[model samples]
Target: MLLERILRFFIVLIMAIVGGTLFELAVPTANAYFTAPLWHEEIAVLGLSPAGLLCILCGTALGGMIGYPLAPFVTGWLRRLSLWVEAQLGKMPTRDVIAGAMGLFIGLIIARLLGDAFFTIPIVGDYIPIVFSIVLGYLGVHIMVRKQQELAEVFDFIPRFFRDMPRVREARVAPQAPAAVRDGQTDRQYKLLDTSVIIDGRIADICETGFLEGTLLIPVFVLEELQHIADSADSLKRVRGRRGLDILQKIRKESRMKVEITEADFEEIAEVDSKLLQLAQEVGGKIITNDFNLNKVAQLRGVSVLNINALSNAVKPVAIPGDLMTVQIVRPGKEHGQGLAYLDDGTMIVVDGGYRCMNEVVSVEVTSALQTAAGRMIFAKLTR
Candidate 1:
C-alpha cells in the first residue's frame, strides 16, 4: 500500500509538471494575440498575472485528478511485470543469463552503428533503428543462447593472451585433441546416477568403499522423477522414492567423491533413460546404474555403463567342483530328490539327494557351478 501511494505521488507530480508547462507557455501567447487585460493583469503578491496563476493551478489540479485514478492500474501492472521477469530469471541458469546479457549488449552496439547510417533517410528514418534494435537484440539472444556450448568449445581453442582479440578465428588452434588432453591433463569423467541405482541403495555403499571415482552427477530431471515417485499414491513406490532421496543425501554426506546436481535437460526426449544416455554421450561420462535394460541399451549406443549388479556378481566368492561346503536345506527343489539351499550372499545352492534333509543343515560337496545372467548357482550332493 505504501509503495502504491509513492508511485501515485510520482505520477501526479510528473503529469502536473507537464500540464503546468503547457499552460505557462500558452499564457504569453494568449496575451500577445488578444491584448486582454485579464491575461496581463499582474498580481502584487506573486508578481504573476491572475490568469497565468489560475491556469497553472488548474493544470496542476487536472493533472492530479487524472493521475489519482490511474495510479492503481499502473502500479499493479508494474508489479505483475516485475514478478514475471523474476520468475523467468529464476528458471534460467547463470551461464545462460550471462550469455543473454552479452548478446543483448552486442546487439545494441551493432544497432547503434547501423542506425547512424540510415538516420538521414526520409519518413521511416526515426523508426528504422528501433526496429533494428528489437530484431537484432532478439536474434542475438537466441543465437547466443542456443549455441552457447559450441561457443564455449570454440573459445577453448584460443590461446589465453589472444582470447581478448577480436579476430578469434586467426588465433584459434586446429581442432585436434580436447583442451584438457592438450594441456597434459586428464579430465575426470562424470559418473551419472540413475533413479534405479539410487533406489537400490547399494551405490551409496559402493561409494563409501571408495571404489567409484570421479564426480557423481544427478540431473534435475532424475530428481524430479524421484520427487514424483515419492508423492505417488502407491505406498511401495513412494517408499522406494523416499529411500532413493535418502540414499542420495547419504552419498553426498559420506562419499569421498564430489556430488553435483545439474540443471541440464533435454526437452525433446521424453524418457528418462534416453535422456541419461544422451547426457552421457554429450558429457563423455559413464552411467552407473543397476537397471539391466538400461545397461544393455547404453552398451548398444556405445555409451559406457557401470552396472552395479554386474559388479556385485563379479565380486561374489567363487565355488569350484569338489569344494566342500555346509548348507541348510530350506525347501525341496523342483527336481526329484533335490533340496535347495542358499549361501549367505544369496547364491542358490542345489543339493542333490538331500531332499530328506529338508530343514536340516548338512555337509555337501560341490559338483559344479553354473554362472547365469541372473547370478551364480552351485550344484552339489549330500556327503556321508
Candidate 2:
C-alpha cells in the first residue's frame, strides 16, 4: 500500500509537468490562429501582458487540475502490469533464465557485426539489420534455454580455471579458532528436513537418541505447507499434518540437537520439493527425507540426501532365508493364501499359507527378503 501511494505521487507529478508543457504550447498556437481576430488591441490581463503572465498562470492551473484526478488510475494500472510480468518471470527456472540472457547478449553482438557489413546495400539495408537482430536474438534465447543443462556442463571449465590458478605467497598468520570450537561444539552440518520426514515422526526419536548431529534447518515454507495440511478437510491429512507439527515441537523442546527455523525462500520455484532441493544446494547441506521420488530427484541434481526409510532399512534386524520367527498374521496379502505381518521395526513379513491363522501367532520360516525403494519385505512360509 505504501509503495502504491508513492508511485501515485510520482505519476501525478510527471503528469502535471506534461500537462503544463502541452498548455504552454497550446497558448502560442492559439495566439497565431485566433488571438488577432478576437482582440482589437493588446490588453494587460492578470496585471501583465495577455500573452505573458496570464497565459502562464492559466496553463499552470489547468495542467495541475487535470493531472490531479488522473494519476491514481494510471499508476494503479502500471503497478498491476508490473506485478503480472514479475509473476511470469518467477515461474521460469533460474538456470534457464540466466542461459537465455547470456545467449541473447551474444546473439546481439554477432548481429551488430553482421549488420555493419550490410550497411552499404540500399533502403532494404536499413531494415535488414533490425530484422536479423530480432530473429537471431529470439533463436539464441530459445536454444540456450532448451539446452541449459548441457550449457552448465560446458561452463564447468570456468570454475576449474579458477581452481587451477596459482595463489600468491604472503607472510603466514596464526589461524583463528573455528566457529564450532568457539560455540561449544554447536556448529554442525545443516540437515534440512523435508515435509515427508517431518510427517513420518521418526526424526524426533532419532534426534532424542543423539544419533543425528548438526542443526535441523526447517524452512518457513515447509511449516506453511504443514499448516495447510492441518487445515485440510480430509481427516487423515489433518492428522498427519498435526502430527508433523507436534514432532517438530517435540524435537525443539526435548531433543539434544539444535533446531533452527529458516525464513529463506525461493519465490521462483512453486513446488516445495524443488525449493528444498535448491535450498540444499545453496546451503551446501544434506536433505533429510523419506520421500522416494524426492530422494531420486535430489540425487539426480547432485544434492546429498539422507532418506529415513533407507536408514531404517539398514538398521533393522536382518532376516535371512530359512530363518524361523514367530509373527501374528494380522491381514491377508495381495497374493492368495498369503498373510501379512509386521516386525517390530515395521518390516513387512508375508507369511505363506497363514491366511487361515489371521490374528493368530505362528512360527514362520523366512523364504526370501526383498529390499525395495519403499522398504524391506520378507516372504516366509508357516512352519509345519
Candidate 3:
C-alpha cells in the first residue's frame, strides 16, 4: 500500500511539472517569466558566450539533483510538525499559516529590495538569498512553537468551554452508580448502629423500607468493638454483640443495597467513633448509627451521618406538649420525684410525680418536649 502511494505521489508530481511547463510555454506572461533566466545575467565569472548560458542551466539542474535526496527529510519533518501540533492543541488547530506566509513574504521582500546591494558585497553576497530564507523561516517556526504553549494562558478556558457547550448540560449527573446503591436519595448514606439499636433490631426495618440508598459499610473496627462487647462477662453485652452480627447478616442477605464489611480500624484513636469518622472520609460515604457522639463526630469532620434514632424520631407521631397521653411508667428517673415512660418508638416520656404508678399504666399530661440529636424526650406529669 505504501509503495502504491509513493508511486501515485511521483505520478502526480511529474504530471504537475509537465502540465505547468506546457502551460507556461502556451501563455505569453508565463513564457516571458520562465524564459527570463534567474541568476544568469548576474554571473559574469562564466564567459557571456553560449557556453556560459549552457553552464548556468547545468548548474541549476545540478542544484535540483542535490536537493532530491532531501525531499523525504523535508516531507517527514512537515508531517511530524502538523501531527504534533494537533496532539498538543486538540480542538483548536495550532497551525500558524499566517506566520509562515508572513515569513515567506518577508524573505522575498528582503531578497528583492537588497538583491543588488547584497550582490555588490564580497563573497557573502552569493549566499544572501539562502541565508535570508533560513532566517525568516526559522522566525516563523519559532513563533508557531511558542504558540503551542498558549494553552497555559487559557487554563481557565477548559471549565468555561465545558459549561458553554450545550451537549454537556447534565455534566453533574452522578455516573451510573452500582445497582446496589438504591437507598432512596438518602444522601448515599450509611447509618451506624449503636450496640443498643442493633440489639433493638429496628435497623433491619429501616433497611427494608429502602430509605437508605448508599453502600452499608460496616467498619471492621466496629465489628471488633462488637466482638469485644460480646466477649465481656456481662450477659447484656454478649446479647447486644450477637444481635449486631445478626442484623449485619440480614442486611447482607435481604437487601440489594451493598453491605460491605470493611476492616478499617484506627487503633491510634482509642475511640471506635473516631475510627468510624476516618473510615467514612476514606470511603466518601455517610455514617449511619444511633450513637449521638458518633453522629456529632461525623458531622464535625464533614462526613455525612444517618442516625437511626433520628429517623425513628422523625417518623414518630408528633405529640405536642399540653396533650395528655396514657403510658406505663417503666422506670424511675434520675431525680427522686421523677418517673419515666417510653413511647412505642422509644421516645422517653419523663413523667413528673408519677412514682406511685411505677410498673403500671397511667395517664400523663405532656409538658415540654425536649428534642436533641439523641432523640425526642417528652416531659410529662401524672394527672391521673
Candidate 4:
C-alpha cells in the first residue's frame, strides 16, 4: 500500500511537469504567430507578460487537477503489469531466466554497436536498427535458454574459488563447539519422498523400524497430485490416492522422525519425476522412491536415490541352490508340470514337478534364483 502511494505521487508529479512544459511552449508559439499583431500596448508591468503569466498559472493548476485524479488509474495499471510480468517469469525455470537475462544484455550491447553502423544508411536506416535489436534479442534468449545447462558449467570457477579459500581466525578467542553439538543434533540430511514410495506404504513401515534417518521432505506438488488422484473417477485410483494420504498422515502422527511438507516446486518441469530431480539438486538431498524409472533418471543425473524396492531386495533372506524350504503351491506356472508359490514377503517360487501339489504346502529344493526388474524369482523342485 505504501509503495502504491509513492508510485502514484511520482506519476502525478511527472504528468504535471509535462503539462506545464507544454503550456509554456504553446504560449511562446501563440505570442509569435497570433498575439503580436493584435496587441500594441505594454502587456507586462514587470519582466513577466500578463498573457504568459496567465497561461503558466492556468496550465500548472489544470495539470495538477488532471494528474491528481488520473494517478490512481495509472498506478493500478502499472501494478497489474508488474504482476503479469512476475507470473510469466515464475513459469520459466530459474536457469532459463538467468540465461535469458545474460543473453538480453549481450544482445543490447551488439545492437548498440550495429546501430551506429546502420545510422548512415538511407530510407530504411531509421527503423532497421530497432528491428535488428528485437530480432537479435529474441534469438539470443532462445539459444541461451536452450543451452542453459552447458552454460552453467562455465561458472564453475565461482564455487571453486570459495572452496579453495582459507579460513582466518583470531588467536585469543575461545574455540566454539561444532555446529552439530551446538544444535544438539547430528548434521541433518534431507530425503525427498516421492508419490510412489508414499503410496506403496513401505516407507511408513521403514520409518517405524528406525533404520531410515534424515528428514523426509514431501513436495506440495506431490501432495497436489495425490489430491487429484483421490478425487479421480476411477475407484482403484481413488482408493490408492486415499491410502497414500492416509499413509502420510500415519507417518506424521506415528513416526518420531521428522517429516516436512515442502512448498518448493519447479513449475517449468511438467513431469513430477523431473521436478523431483530438480528439487533434489537444489536442496542437495537424496530422493526416496520406489519408481524404477525415476531411480534410473536420478542416477543418470548424478542425484542420490534411496529406492525402497532396492532396499527390500537387499534385505530379503538369501536362498541358495540346494537349500530346502516349504512353500504353498497356489497356482500353475506357464511351463508344463510347473507350480507357482509365494513366500510371506511375496517372493515368487516356481516349483518343477509339483503341479499335482496345488493348494498344498510341500518342501522344495531351490534350483536357482534370478533377479529381475520387478523382483527376485526362485526356481525350485519338489523334494522327494
Clashes of each: 0, 0, 7, 0
Cα deviation of 344 in candidate 1 (Å)?
1.2
Per-residue lDDT of candidate 3, residues 57-156 (tens digit): 4554554554456556655776789889767656432244444455557656766666656777788888886776677657655664455335433775
lDDT of each: 0.83, 0.80, 0.65, 0.81
Candidate order by decreasing lDDT: 1, 4, 2, 3
| Model 1 regions more than 4 Å off | 1-186
Q: Which ten residues in a row have the lowest lDDT in candidate 2?
A: 168-177
Give the TM-score of each candidate: 0.52, 0.50, 0.43, 0.51
Q: For every candidate structure, what is the RMSD over all alpha carbons to the true structure, in angstroms?
A: 18.0, 19.6, 27.2, 20.6
Name the top lDDT candidate: 1
lDDT of 2 at 105: 93
- Candidate scoring better on TM-score of 2 and 4: 4
**Candidate with the greatest TM-score versus the true structure:** 1
| Runs with alpha carbons beyond 4 Å of true place in candidate 2 | 1-187
lDDT of model 4, residue 172: 20
101-157 per-residue lDDT for model 4 (tens digits)? 999888878887888899889998888889879988888888787766556556766
State the TM-score for model 3: 0.43
| lDDT of each residue in 1-384, candidate 1, tens digit only | 888788888988888888888787778523333333553543423555567788888888887788888778888899999999999999986667888998888898999899989989999899999999999999889888877767866886577446435433422652222333234444657889999999999999899888888888788889999999999999999999999999998786557777867666788999999998887776678999989899999999999999888898999999989999999999999999999999988999999988999999999999999998899999999998
**What stretches of model 3 exceed 4 Å from their correct place?**
1-200, 232-235, 263-272, 330-340, 350-360, 372-374, 381-384
